[model samples]
Target: MSAIEVLAPGLLTTVQDLGREGFGPMGVSPSGAADPLALRMGNRLVGNAEGAATLEMTLLGGTFLFREGGIGALTGSDFGANLDGTAVPRWASFEVKPGQTLRLGPTRSGARCYLCVQGGIAVKSFLGSASTHLLSGLGGHEGRALRKGDVLKIGDAREAKEKGTDHNASSTEGAHKSNRLRSVAAKALELLAPRKVLRVTPGPQSDWFPKAAQRIFYSSTYRVSEEANRMGLRLAGPAIREGAHGEMISEGVSLGAIQVAAGGLPILLFVEQQTTGGYAKMANVISADFSSLGQLRPRDEIRFELVNFESARKLFIEQEKLLAAKDLIV
Candidate 1:
């Protein structure tokens, strides 16, 4: 069987998919790709399902040896990758021959990068997902970050190739597919352009914060603290002075829920965030900005923009429509 042999596991490389949903009631948060859009695009580029498992490299990237050859693609932040000493472009598909080494370095654009293969990574599923839940250590390859010398099995892509979905079918066909994919990728990039300001809507506990605190949250610039991770990001900015409402009961929290604890600093929940939180959530990031949250790096400066539910819904619909386009890939 075809497989990937890790030569050097980069910082926090892991197998991840779209994540396990509907398990929040069982204390499991949807631990999936940080940049879900990138993962989906990368998978589509390689003729795999959008939720196919792929390697997620954080900050730094890894080196791997492909056995029996394969097709792959890189997405998200550019990590300066090279295959057998030849530089490879991001957001496009490439072929790897037997014994070829693919190496990647530190990120050049954002916090994370994804390496998606045509067949996807073959890992045991937990709760119907191959995503690695870092905090809980339950899914993926042994449920943790990859290590050097680990061998990752690649799934079968014959079905896709037989159906003429593989873009690298022939030299002539490949050139045409490449041009088409480049155009689509360019559009996707524009749609996911980096933004320092994240849009959000009021949370259930938005009233807990006074108008002044709400104003501060909306206007002030906050830096992502060093304490940021998949679980959440702690912001270092002006302390939000919330109205004194006695400690309330803990409730369920969702991705991008900004919780303000005793110190008044906001903790922006992420993919691996807890199922529930007790701190008062002053705001909730709109769904359209979820991919923006994934690209954030330590000490990165960010701001918040307030929008109504209707506006947020519209933004989400527009993004989904673009992602769901039939011409997203060749």
Candidate 2:
């Protein structure tokens, strides 16, 4: 199949897949979609599987000329994309004709956006995944961002159903449970704004802090600080102190591990987080609410809530069920 020719690469675009798994124990970071939800939903809109390699565009997207006929989807940020000078709707799959010129501008809403083609973007694999480890320079366009004049191959074209015409059908959630959406099923097709409410589970080191510290974490409002990125997000808010607590050896770190630094500042870890950290972790923003977290830009206001592991699991299940039901109609 012909590939998409990069004419004018955007600010920060890279080819990514579902992300490398089972390599965390080896000190290799699980570098995947900073926003897995957008990756999955965008791929679903097209005909690609959840783990397929796609393009991750930062705030500003770029231009590309389709050399082969295919279909694609754009999700997450609204960068005001267009095809051959005609506007293309966000969160929907559209036909990409050969020789067509597609253009994307700087982000207007969310910080990142994903572009999923019918045939996934084919990139070199590292550690068994196509995701790019920016820090270590693994599986991407030579472990770097996409460049102008790059010719990335697209998977061979296969006929897919009329692009999500079916409704009410359930979908698989994170390789585990199946969920069904009950409410707002009617608005599945209607273009709307992002509905974001992030829920979180307690961290492994929650007990390290006192009761008052925990209360402040949940009570004080926070915003995404300017010093945030794929590795971690440094939050700006009340200096949440861990009263009468001392430091310990660094333990396992995950995508949403909330760590309080020496200055009493809080930060949220992301995909490129270190294998271990020594900071005091208070809680973890659960997987279900991670999409919203990924959307946050510098100074974006947000709130936090505490939850148990079981409750967090249940929330994740519920979200997956909702997405499944939307699959039926949208």
Candidate 3:
């Protein structure tokens, strides 16, 4: 099988699938797509499974050379995508021929870009997934970012056909680099707009915070610090005042758990967060918008809206059904 050739490696591009399942008990984070919806949609565009192994490109993804003909769909962050020197429409299905080079330069909108090819990337897994958990050093191409000269064997190129409509694959403005994903309406909007609000529900330890902290939590706009990454997002804002029990015995912390440290700063846990955390959890981001939380940039402002668990679950299921697994591209 002819694999993708890493000609100019992006800042940090790695092979990731849906993520590792059933391993959180052992403290393995499901380190897969930063924007899972985009990943899954892209996979569907290429007639791949929802959790097929794809490339997770960072803020500035590098270039690659596809040696054979296949359907390639790019989602998540639009890092100035170009399908062989011409502008590649995003949010819509596009095709790449063998020997063509796909370029993803710096991003103009979100933080990560997910590239899904036909079929899926053929990489061995450590724990039933192709996602790479860098902290635990599991999955992906040796659990690290891709470098020049690395070759990734892909699944059958011919069978990797796109499954959806490419409705939003047209060009948009301010696309020096863009992340124009296919909206429900199939519009190609630029991703450089204002950072979006991230809704959340009060945490298991939300009561640990004082009244002052709770009030500030919902009202104030918090900025994501540069210290943020796949594991957690460190925010800069008014320190979240906590109760006397600064640190509790470690307990399971689900994805999107927001823990406030001793100094009062809040951190939103992501796919790579530890199974257990001692810091007081100020809030829990709903799974529905977990991918949006992963897209925050440095200095991006995000406000939280409180929702009940039942409401959150409903929103999650509704969102899941919004886009079907079939014919994701136009």
Candidate 4:
């Protein structure tokens, strides 16, 4: 079996996939890739299954040494990646040689980056998922961020060769063929700007807040607080006016739930959010823009735009089509 030796663990590198589903009832958050779309795309570029485990790097990237030759690709944020001192392109697959070192520096644009190997990371699964849920210390490499001297087992790259074409060919050859399509897809990912306008719909407890609170939520620009994390994004903006009956029974919370805490500030629940929350939810982010939220950094400004359920569904469909298009892959 092949392995990757960690020379330096980035800010918050972890092994993740599509996330653990059907375990929320057990109080296990669907801890997975903050940017699922990027993780899937990276896996696709390397000819791996969409749900294959990949390394999720936070703002800063780490260095690693491949003990065996294999194929790998980087997606999401461009973190000035270089393989053996040679600058490599993002959103494209490249080959790695035995004993070669791959290094990634600080991020230039986005908040997170996904590094996918040809055969995915081979980690023990919990709750049928290999994702690392930090809060609960469940799944993935002992459920913690990778540390120095950690050795991660990787699947056999030859297994991918049996699937027709060699997706892990040299970068020059692969780049020449799919440069244009990759460029288009890469551009779409880059459109997630520092200041973004996210689409949202009324939450289950939308009526719990006063009308003034709703107006402020939709109209005000909120800054992503420095305290934000994978579990939720804390926003700093105008205080929302809660109704006299502010207290409510704890209820189930879903991804993208905009829960208003006691301080009147809103916190957007994310992949690692608790199964249930006591805060009153005023709105929910549309599924189509979850990727946008994933790329947000602390202090980034954001505004919410209201949309109907039907429109949200249509947008989600369009997003799926864009990611699943055959032309996007080589």
Report, for every candidate in turn, its global Cα lDDT versus the true structure.
0.84, 0.74, 0.74, 0.80
lDDT of 4 by residue, 1-330 (tens): 889999999999999988877876788888888888787778777766677788999999999999996788998888999999999888888888899999999999878998888878989878877899988788889999999899999965444323222212223223343222233254555443222799999988888877887888889999999877889999999988664245679889889999887778888999999899887888999988887888898988999998999999998887676666655565
User: Which candidate achieves the best TM-score against the true structure?
Assistant: 1
**Maximum-lDDT candidate:** 1
Can you give the TM-score per candidate against the true fold? 0.92, 0.87, 0.88, 0.90
Worst-scoring 10-residue span by lDDT in model 4: 163-172
Using lDDT as the yardstick, the better of models 3 and 4 is 4
Give per-candidate clash totals: 0, 9, 11, 0
Q: Give the per-residue lDDT of model 2 (tens digit) for 1-330.
A: 669998988988988766777887899888788877677776666655556778988878989999876778887889999999999877777887889988999989888888888767876678877788888887888998889999888875342222121221333322221121111223542322343445678887788878888788788888888887778889888887764244668788888888888777788998878888888788888877777776778888777877788988987787666566634224
- Taking the tens digit of each residue's C-alpha lDDT, what string does model 1 give over 1-330? 799999999998999888888987789998899988888778777766677789999999999999888888999998999999999988888889999999999999889899998778989889988899998888999999999999999987643233321222222222243223332446667877757799999988999788898888888999999888999999999988675243568899989999888888899999999999788888999998998888999999999999999999999989877777665554
Q: Is candidate 2 or candidate 4 better by lDDT?
A: 4
Any runs in candidate 2 off by more than 4 Å, and if so which? 159-197, 244-246, 326-329
- Candidate 4: where are CA atoms >4 Å away? 158-195, 244-246
As for candidate 1, its clashing pairs are: none
The Cα error of candidate 1 at residue 207, in Å, is 1.0
